[model samples]
Target: MPDLPSGAVTFLFTDIEGSTRLVKQLRDRYAEVLAEHQRLLRAAFAAHGGHEVDTQGDSFFVAFASARDALLAAVEGQVALLSHPWPEGVQIKVRMGLHTGQAVATGGRYTGLAVHRAARIGAAGHGGQILVSQAAQTLLEDEEEDLHVFLRDLGEQRLKDLDRPVRL
Candidate 1:
């Protein structure tokens, strides 16, 4: 198993939008599409030191040592997915969400509120959209690295099952 990050970690959660519809539409080819999607995402994530925490169906939960790495991985993954040629001119759009906070990693899984927050943030976004929680954004803003990444204030909003509202 890969070494999952412990303590303060940036979590990135992603999933394909309308995957059921895509599966129905693509049938046998859907498996191939999913495989390619995973490949592209894994490559991008690994390139930026992202640890693959978990993946189920068309969703991925990855951890990064830094918020910047997580954001960079998301951007690279999105670009790769968009540019890839699918078998039937099909577009596979993935939604990504990032959050940075304290967490505990044990037995190849993470246990903490931050993990849930990250998953909820990702669930709130549309396919092809990358959402960042305020926690992650704050860390990113403090970094000196010029990622050339810009974020528009999505305004604070309450996410499902989350006690406090998050700024997207």
Candidate 2:
């Protein structure tokens, strides 16, 4: 296992939307598609210095030490997924969410509201969309224009079980 991120960390969570439908449609071929999807996403995330924290079914939970790296990994992962040619021309859309906050790392797992908030943020997004919390966005404010990405104001979104709405 790789070293996990600690303290102030930016997390990237991703889930394949309508995955059960995909499984029904693809059947046995679904495994191949899933493997390729994971490969692409893992490659993209690793390239941006992301550590694979966990994978639950068709969802991935990754951690990054840098806020910019987390966002960049999300973009790269999305682009890779979009560009991949799936078996039988099937399209796989994954939703991602990013958040930056302090968390406690224990026994190779993270425990804190920040972790829950990050998961909720990812759960609230639609496929192909990368939703970023205001905290993560703020951390990227000092980034260079060379990053070549736009952070559109998406207003505030209320995540599941969260007390307050998070600006995206």
Candidate 3:
């Protein structure tokens, strides 16, 4: 795994979709499913040079040196979850969001509007969806990598606590 960023970095937030329902639906087996979910997601993050910031329940906050790397981790995580075989017929889906901006890294944690914006973007997305902020999208625009083909223009989106709509 790559070193975790200590300064300005891209933030990636992920939450298991329908977690409450899954918890009740899976009951005793939920713990096993959750462990697998964490393993799968952490593997993707490691592969993409992401540093885990915090995780509470099914939500994870990760940091990456590059916005592209953060986005790649999100895609990789989603793809992994989509194909994972759950116990019984249960299913798990995750919603991920990414944003690139300056953050204050203190005590191994990041704080600032960038973190909040990243969380809001994650909340706005549905299961299996990857949402990127305008800043991040612009960073990837000049690149000719195959990743560009997977990005969907969601247009401008009004995020919570933000004063204006941002081009997504």
Candidate 4:
């Protein structure tokens, strides 16, 4: 098993936007493009103390011990993707979300509202956008990092199947 936090953790979720259309548009070389994307993402994640949780196609779920590391990983991942030479001249954009909460990790799986909420926040974002929960924002404020993190308040948003609107 990877050295993931078993209790309190911050989750980062990422998804590729318009992946289906990109695949259709880039056809033969889409696989190579995606491979490069995954590689870049993994490198950024690893560099910033992130633990790989799950990844499918053009999405990734990662866990971090601190909000600082998680947020930095997200920002650096975006920077890397923007600078990569995408194959076949195809452009790609990704959305990311983060939420800090306690979760149960057993047998290599994470189950809890934190994870679900994180995924929903990611889904609600536009390509190249990052959405972070209020909990994560608080964590950010509590920790000082060398790199600055800036966020635009989205206010409380009603998320899919969530009981209360989450502050994003």
TM-score of each: 0.96, 0.96, 0.92, 0.95
Model 4 alpha-carbon drift over 4 Å, by segment? 142-145
Q: Write the per-residue lDDT of candidate 3 for residues 44-134, one digit (tens) a residue.
A: 9999989998999999999999987888888889889999978777879898988888888877777888889888998889998988888
Residue 10, model 3, lDDT: 87
- Number of clashing residue pairs, candidate 1: 0
> Once model 4 is optimally superposed onto the true structure by TM-score, how far is the C-alpha of residue 38 displaced, in angstroms?
0.1
Give the winner by lDDT. 1
Task: Give the per-residue lDDT digits (tens) of candidate 2, residues 8-120.
Answer: 99999999999999999999888988989999999999899998889988999999998999999999999999988776658899999999999988778888999999999
Which runs of model 2 end up more than 4 angstroms from their true locations?
none
Candidate 4 per-residue lDDT, tens place, 1-168, comes to: 675687779999999999999989988888988998999999999999898999998999999998888899999999999988776567889999999999998888899988999889888898888899999998787554455766778999999999999999
Whole-model alpha-carbon lDDT for candidate 3: 0.86
Which stretch of 10 consecutive residues in model 3 shows the poorest summed lDDT?
142-151
lDDT of 4: 0.89
Q: Ten consecutive residues with minimal summed lDDT in candidate 4?
A: 141-150
Give candidate 3 regions above 4 Å deviation: 1-3
Question: RMSD per prediction, one decimal?
Answer: 1.2, 1.1, 1.9, 1.4
